[model samples]
Target: MPTAEEIRRRIIEHGLSIRDRVIATMPQRYSLMVEQIRSIARSYRGDFDTFLTNLSSIKGLDLLVIYTALLAVLSKHKSLSDEEILKIGDSFDRHIYDVFSASKARRALEEAGVEKEIANDVISGVVKALNLINNKYNSPYLWIAEQRRIERFENSVREVLFRNEGGNRVGRGVKLFLRLFIHDTNIPLAVRIAYTQENKKYILHGDMYTALVTLRSGAFEDVASITAERVKARVAKRLLCEAKEGGARCKDVVMRLESIRGLVRYVGKISGDPIVYERGAYDIGYRYCRDLKCEACPINDVCKRYTFIKLK
Candidate 1:
């Protein structure tokens, strides 16, 4: 088995670009994107939880609905500015969030003083350009889920929402936004960790993987199981915890699955939490690995990807 010292060393070697000084363009771009997202989220000033908690309240979830709907539209396309999204929202139906159809977008654009032909062309151009940019960023759809996952997530979301609130307490806009945003297959593994595991800490995908690797580097079944024993152990552990005085319960709900991924990655890392692997990879890949900047890296000698291919 690897010693505690070895495991700690490996953990330290992880995220070389992030922890080390290897200033590059991609990381700088990601930094700016993060700053912009923080600026945007801070504008909300902590009211999202209230909107989420009270679906049918007097204020209705109008603001949250609008923002998330815009997110649904803008997520795949980053070049489109927040102002453009707001303008599109100005003409949006607020209810027609099912597909975020190009037709709907064109109509909205036309309403926003754009010529009809130009609106169609603009939407087409935006999608094409974003797809091209993403390919450059991380070889096309590095983080997005496959189509099958999307379908399953849509079904799962509908079932869970119906089961939880019986379809009455929740707002339709919330449901639509959730369906698009959480589309089962597309959800990140890190997000599922935070949700199903009910993890109290902000452990990124890499942290979870690091924990597993650290535990399983040697010895059979020392920390991993090849049977149903693991699930049972977790449940038993939880039950035992609940048996304690006052019992253990989730102290705070985690961030929404629908929140901005890049921002989450950036913010989580800055605060010394696990950042999502794919998002972090996107930053590291474009900034350093793609350029083969090992010489500039402080921990290059220990980095696992020291010999990784340098490609765009």
Candidate 2:
């Protein structure tokens, strides 16, 4: 029966505790490295944004560096279980495969004389470059191997997405992918560190809502965004319908909406644009709970919200 404020407090406490645990478990050398990396990364936030916006201009070597940096930071985690490490590896492999595949597709289109129809010049360039690299290597086997690796990675991503847990799947996925990519021996250490820091900043501040909004607005070159109004309206409708079906009081539904509104406000303060954040938060919350009360239900017992009637 935690009040809304109490639940918020708990979330903050839990987040802080988790951050501390991650920091505590890091090796001394890694801890020092992370600090240095963070300082360098702080200076490049704007540059990073620009890079994301102009991802096509990024060379294969630059991409490789980003992957390496991410892996280095992930290596500092002392508590990652064997399975977890494997999972991370799988995710990273998938991300790499995706890049490779896109590059290959672009090449095929260009070879077929259809590059102009593709519209995305960056994608076209990447594909053409990948094709050139393949030709230079004189190894179709490499492209084949990349395709197989991407398939495996995609399966892992699907499993992570569908799992029924409130745990931070996206965060975990990002962390795992970063580590493997950065640690890859083929990539340079400096590039790996640089890319890892850039990704870390995105994860630390970017929530599902922010990601969706960015996608909708088409502001980001790589990732997509969604409209704030559409997201909020959808979530509000779902919550209201759920409450109505569950025989909950109108006042309770109103309170629930209010609680969601509060979350939106908080996210806005942290992320900028309260309206977009609020809509995104509501969408996430609704989707997280689906048709049932989650473990983190703020108004469970006293609220008398139930989809199924009890047999007294």
Q: What TM-score does each of the candidates earn?
A: 0.29, 0.27
- Which residues of candidate 2, in runs, are more than 4 Å off? 1-5, 16-61, 64-263, 266-288, 291-293, 296-312
For each candidate, how many residue pairs have backbone atoms clashing (under 3 Å)? 2, 18
Per-candidate Cα lDDT values, in order, are: 0.33, 0.33
Encode model 1's per-residue lDDT on 123-142: one tens digit a residue.
Answer: 66444534453454331112
Name the 10 consecutive residues with the lowest summed lDDT in model 2: 181-190
TM-score of 1: 0.29
Residues 1-312 of candidate 2: C-alpha lDDT, one tens digit per residue: 433333333333333332222233333433444454344334443364432333333234333422222332233322243344344334444445334455453443344333344413434333443455356533322221122132243333223222222234434433333222221121112232334432122122233332332222222222122433444454456557666774353322112222233333333344422222333333433333234444453323222222221111
